[model samples]
Target: MASDSSADVVIVGTGVVGCLVAERALDAGLSVLMLEAGPRVDRWRIVENYRNLPPSMRLFHWDAPYPPKPWAPHLETRVAKESEQYLQLEGPNARAYLQGYVRYAGGATWHWAGICWRLTPEDMRLKSLYGVGRDWPFGHDVLEPYYTAAEYAIGVCGPSDPALQWPPNAERSKPYPMGPIPFGPGETRLTEAAARIGMMNLPAPQARNSGVSYHGRPPCCGNNNCFPVCPIAAKYDAATALPKIEAKGGKILANAVVYRVETGEKNAVEAVHYFDPNKVSHRVTAKLFVIACNGIETPKLLLLSKDDRNSNGVANSSDQVGRNMMDQPKLFAEVELAEPLWTGVGPVQSSSILNTTQGEFRNRYAGAMFRMENFARSPLGSAAALKKGLVGKALDTEIRRLSACTARLTVEHEPLPLPINRLTLSSKTDWLGINKPNIYYDVSDYVRRSAKEYTVPRLQQLASELGATSFQLSPEFLNSDHIMGGCIMGSEAATAVVDADCRAHDHQNLFLPGGGAMPSGTASNSTLTMAALALKAADAITAQLKHG
Candidate 1:
């Protein structure tokens, strides 16, 4: 066993949320330490890994570039059997929760599309507005300042014009750090086509640098490789914060898999126990502990930390620690257009139709956010052409035609935080003898009804407007990887795992922020919301530390 280390604040994950909290804590002059289960690697190493991948794996294998460590295993999406070794899924929509995320130092921000969507005021008051899902304890007004702070911290770029803003009446405290990136030929065509159908294709707020650099990172060069790995640091990722965090006197321990969160008097977290790759045990004590490991891992850790005092697991007094699992259950549509839209000129995702996300229809079913994927179709086109056994000029022509004429449209439906959708500790163990994350996910009739009644028709309309020769909508719901609600937040401690400040109800010194604490997901990427919540929690943590 190694000797115990100590700090003012200890964070269990080095992802964006953890990094955000660490930065703020460090800024507040609190000594911070971040423990990451995964190994620390340079951005260039990940870039090389992406470049060396087979063309077939390049598109969908977003986590392929960052191989998971044996001790800190994550899903290996390319191989189903291998992936099952980590996350165990069941239920009618188990496949829908087959989350694709990297267990590297930076976390999923390494492979995200960088879209920063703020939940509308109505989204926060789900129960009040539509009487479907749980409402947030606080409104969007309370989170607005944190949203702006998060956007600034992550170097978000978006249109200054309020008309182009998502939820245009959001009442932003500040403008975007940088201007919005102009749409590519494909996005431009789609925007025009969507406008004709009474839809607004507004510029999405993204973390990538648009023109001039805001932070130390360079402007986006349009590598069209935002996923898997951004070759250049044009886009924001948590790995970029590691150096800055260290520069600010914060310590980061990589390849340190934290398994148990030890609690003491009054059920406050006293220390956290971790294991090295060699199975050696180590302990670290802190004034406060923040578990910012994504939605799945955070709840999994809490459930794994069962003790004599807390038999149901730490922070599970309400028995809601690993319940209410949620994500934006997605429906994809592949469209073959009449013209050469020619996507892949800018970031992988730059704009979306957020108008669909807000509507009176939420009383019956979920609302959704729709977007035309900006990922280049060349690789998929080439694979399809090759399967036909075409040769020479014929093969080249077919590949070009398919690549230029096809586009993928996706609709992500809002999910209700149902207690039935839950995450439990599986009997199966990983390399380090820790129980794997077992999830029972059902996209529920809320999303399914939205797809069948609302979103599908809208998708067909857009495809028709784009002059589609052929259109194919996915038969099943897919995972957006925007995991949320495992440690759901609310005012009452009896029903929720965490409070509005993301502070665990069972423990005063413990905070669990990010996606896990979010009560509702408004049909968009949850990263920005996660980041905003992290910032909000950071403020609360700072106040608690300073006062107590």
Candidate 2:
């Protein structure tokens, strides 16, 4: 083993949250080190990989370009046999909990849709106001400034008008850095159709350049390939920020899978142990440590690092490290409209109906967010046509017809945090000889009741408003890829892993910020909230260093 390495601060995982924290720390004149579990990937390489995919795999294999390393295996959703080897799942809704995240240098943000939504004030105080789900340690007001900072950091574009803004009443210090992306024909038609039912469809705030360039990124050209990989760098991804951090003198180590966190005097984290691809081990020491890995991997790493003083885990004094897992349970409706709506023209998603996101009925049932999916239908329609044994002209005609008339609408419901839905280390080991993660997940009655009683009926109603000839709702719930609530935050140490500032209760110098620290899943994409929490933690760390 090499002699112990040291730095002013060390961050694990190079996702959006991790990069943002590194930027903040480096700006504060602290020597920072970033440890990434996956290899450094480039844009052209990922684009080439996408182009090489077989036609059958091109439609849904978003993680194919960023293949998982043997030593650091993330869940592979494309191949069923290989995916089952990485994660051991058991629960009533176990299959629905399969998540697709990349372990590459920039993490899962490489393939995200870039929709950014801020949680409402009511969302943070769920328990006190509606008698459900645990409340966040602080309300939205405390995190609002951080949200604005995160938006600017990521280069978001949204409407300046309050009527088109999300959460319409959210407190804003200024307008978005760039104006909102124009609505395409599909979105315009969907917005009008939704209004007939007394619902309002608002423009989605996204992390993509709208008109002129900002932060050296070009404006979006509307190729509609936001998923899998963006051919152009118009969309914001952590990979774009990595170079900026390095330019500011931050050091990054790739393919270094951290396995153990060493605890020293007073149970403070002194160093962490990681192994290279060649199985060579090294130790890194730092004054302050931040684990910005996403919800699942963050807690999994904590539970893996067990010591004599902390037999359960490093930060598991309250045994809440890998409990209270939450994700937005999703359902889909595929409908064939009587008229051709021409459903694909711009981004994969641009607008959504916001009426059902909150209400007094939340005391009884879960709330949901609904959107019309804007993915191009040619690939899916072609596959279906081939399955029906059509050929040549018949196949081409059917593909075109389906591409123009078919529309997919999705409903994502907020799930209450349940301790029973948890993650644990499996006896099964990976290529690196480390234990695999096992998950026990259930959408719970809170989401199920909402689906059967409210969401499903409303979905049918929307399809009717569009004059659909054939409409079918998926029977099983799906994962929205918004993993949250593993190392949850709260005011009480007995039930939480982190505090309002995202600092671990047991280890003052350790911070775990991101979706894992989120106490509530509010029926929206959790990336913006995760970034906001990271900014808040960064401020706290900077203040502590100043006092010292």
Candidate 3:
């Protein structure tokens, strides 16, 4: 093994959370090193990859554009038959646990819809308020400042009117960085239709620019390709923040798959061992280390790094390194409306009916957020038309009809952390001969009960109210990609992997930020919360360094 260098801090993963932590640490005048397991990729390259995809792959373009590197294999949900290659899923809800995350330099943010929703105050104290799940160590009021900081860093565009804002009651220290992106015709119509049912459809706060540029990126032009790849750099991705980190004196080592973390006296992480694409191992040492490799990979890395001192795993003294897995179980309904709603004029997901996200019913069932999916349906319609054997004008007409009339409404339900739904090391190995991540997941009775009793029935009623001639709810739950809860945070070291500040209780110098430390999964995209937690952890790390 070669020992090249060391830094003040070493961070794994180059996702939004990792990049944010790097930027903050570099700003504090600390030399930082980031290790990304996958190869560095450009935005235009991803766009080109999407464009080059065959018609059959276009429907699943999110997974098509970003192919996994050999050294850093991510889950591929497109090929159902090959699901066991990277993630060996088990249990009743294992099918729904097939996550869609990329291991590239930018991580999963490259293809995220950019929805930036904050956790409500109630969302923080789930166990206290509703008698289910675990509460965050701190409340929303504590994380509000960090939430604001994260929003400004990512250049969020949200509604100026408090009514349209997410968790409209959230205490705001400042308004959104930019005004809301105007709703497209589909969203406007859906909003109006929802109003008729006494439900409110509010503009979604997104990480894309709205009007004037804030962070050198141009405003959104509404090409409606927020997924797969945004042709323009209007949407915020970790790749955008990465260059800023490098500019601020941070080094990023791509294709460095960190496999082992070494601990020294007092259980402080001394160094991490990583292998390059050619399988050349290198040891990189640092004063402080952070594992920001999302929910799944972070725990997998911890479990993989079994040392003589910590045989179970690094930071597994609590035996909670890879326990308490959670995600927002999602279901959608495909409906053919009586009139043309024209669903594809702006960003893919601009608005959602969010009132159902919280309520008194949570004690009995799970909470859910509902949204009208805004992805352009032309590709799906065209594929369906072709499969029906339509030709020429018939095909074109069918495609247009389906594109204009069809709409999909999705319901994402919050799932409490379940220890049974855990991530363990699989016997299957990847290209580097490291064990793959095996997850045993079950959504449990909370999600299943909510889907049957509340979400599905409400969706059926809404579809009927929208004048749907053919409406079919999906029978199986799907993964929302809002992965959370593995290295969960708590007050006690015996039950949690990390503390409130995201510091690993077992390893004083190690920090595990992002979704892995989240105690609960709210009914929203978790990137914003993950980023906020990263910023919070950065502050804690800075304090520790100063004191030491």
Candidate 4:
């Protein structure tokens, strides 16, 4: 058995956020430990994990049978197979369309279509201006510096001109750590058509590498597969940062699944008790505990840690830990261009049409476009979802067969919170003895109506301007697996689980960092935001530790 370790700070998950937290916290001279539930991931050896799986299943397939295909749902299910079917948050969702998901050491970063967009000033002020959503106590201006820092650290590449008329939020401090990926021929045709119609379109920023090196990491050769694990280190994965933290005297215990966070009578967390791979129970004590277990796991962990001391959950004083489940509603529609456009070659998520002008779903402050390349309808993924989602084959054979030649663009829109969608404990347990994530989501009438009524027509118009044969939201679509806000941040306990600093409200020394604390997801993906927030939290912790 490995020797138990301790530290002044213990970060529960070694995902990107946790790593950034450790990096910043370590620089501030704090002794830290990162606890990971999976094994130490060697990028080269692990790239094989991406191989041989069906293209449809590649992104979701991790650790072999452990995840099944695509990815397993974190939701509850009395029967395992039935649970997998219900867990898809996308693609033919039995109900709400929030389908695709995957889990790995790097967390979901392993297979994301790399987009790093900042939330708009409007996104933060959801309540004041919109009067429908909650307001972010914090705003983009506050995190802009960190956003720049993370962009460089994670090796982002793009041509941004916040001043540019199209594809809003394109501006950044330095040229990307990696230079921008030029628009492919297929996207270029669509761009011209968009220009013809006065709709803005531009190359979207991507997290994949365009160069041979950045901060000692290799560049992306346009690996078609961003899912599974990047065989080459072209894309940034949190595992890349893990070793640096470990090298700095940080102890990382693997395959140790944490079950409960034991707290003192005063409500400060004392230790996290977990089960090892061998089923041995162990405990790690720390001055502070940080939870970076993604959105679903973070809340589930907090709620599951209940004992005699706290019944509702460790930090359930607010009773809002597992509420406000948010998923970005995606609108994937593109015109079949009159000419052949080689759309399948470059990295996924290549470009986006910037939307700065106010509209129904977006106001001046809402997020901007997060465009990309390979919204390619694979052989199976295409033929099935006719139009946007499929009911039959006539649409599939005609529209999907030519996917190899079509130009693709997607609008990654933010969705409001679904109160009922959450991570609750399941009545059943996996063979590993850990309870799987159980979810219950009810899509709003507003979302269904808006997507069908508004977003779809816009995408169709885009395709038409480009001389597209057709365009429509897929017959099947769902919420993105990029889950956020299960445990939101706010000042009032009635509304949040953690505060702006990502600290647990009920436990002074415990911090919950990651997408779980995000009040709202920006235009791009959450990895960039989570990383920046982790830095801020680490700074706060270091300041307090220094004061004492």
Q: Model-by-model lDDT, in order?
A: 0.91, 0.88, 0.89, 0.66
Task: Give a tens-digit lDDT track for model 3, residues 1-548.
Answer: 11235888899999999999988888887889999999899888998888898866765547778888899988765666665678889999887788888999989999899999998999999899999999988888899999999999999999888777778778788899999999988888888888888778889999999987879888999989898778898999888888898888788999999999999998899999999999999999999999999899999999999898899899998888888988898899999988887888999988888888889999999989888989888887787888899999999999998888899989999999888899999988999999999999899899999998998988987877777899888888888988899999999999899999999999999999999999999788899999999999999988888678
| TM-scores of the candidates in the order shown | 0.98, 0.97, 0.98, 0.86
Give one digit per residue, the lDDT tens place, for model 4 in 370-482.
Answer: 34356344653364444466456666555644665465556655666656666677765664556655666654554555556655666666666666776655564445667
Model 3 ranges off by over 4 Å: 1-4, 391-394
Clashing pairs in 2: none
Candidate 4 Cα misplacement greater than 4 A, ranges: 1-3, 55-102, 164-175, 331-337, 356-403, 407-409
Give the clash count for each candidate: 0, 0, 0, 38
Distance from true location, Cα of 519 in model 1, Å: 0.2
How do the residues 255-274 of candidate 1 rate in per-residue lDDT, one tens digit apiece?
99999999998889999999
Q: After superposition, how far is residue 75 of candidate 3 from its true place, in Å?
A: 1.9
- Strongest candidate by lDDT: 1
For residue 496, give model 2's deviation from the true position in Å. Answer: 0.6
| lDDT tens digits by residue: candidate 2, 1-548 | 11137778899999999999999999999888999989998999999998898876765678777788898898876678877978788898887678878998888889999999888889998999999999988877788899999999999999999887877777698789999988887788888888999778888898989987878888988878788877787889999989998999888889999988889999999998899999999999998999987888888899899999889897888898989888999999999987777766878877788778899889988999989988788887887888899989999999888887889989999988889999999998988888888999999988899998999998888888887899888889888888899999998888899999999999989999999999999898999999999999999988887676
- Superposed on all Cα atoms, model 2 deviates from the true structure by an RMSD in Å of 1.8
TM-score, candidate number 2: 0.97
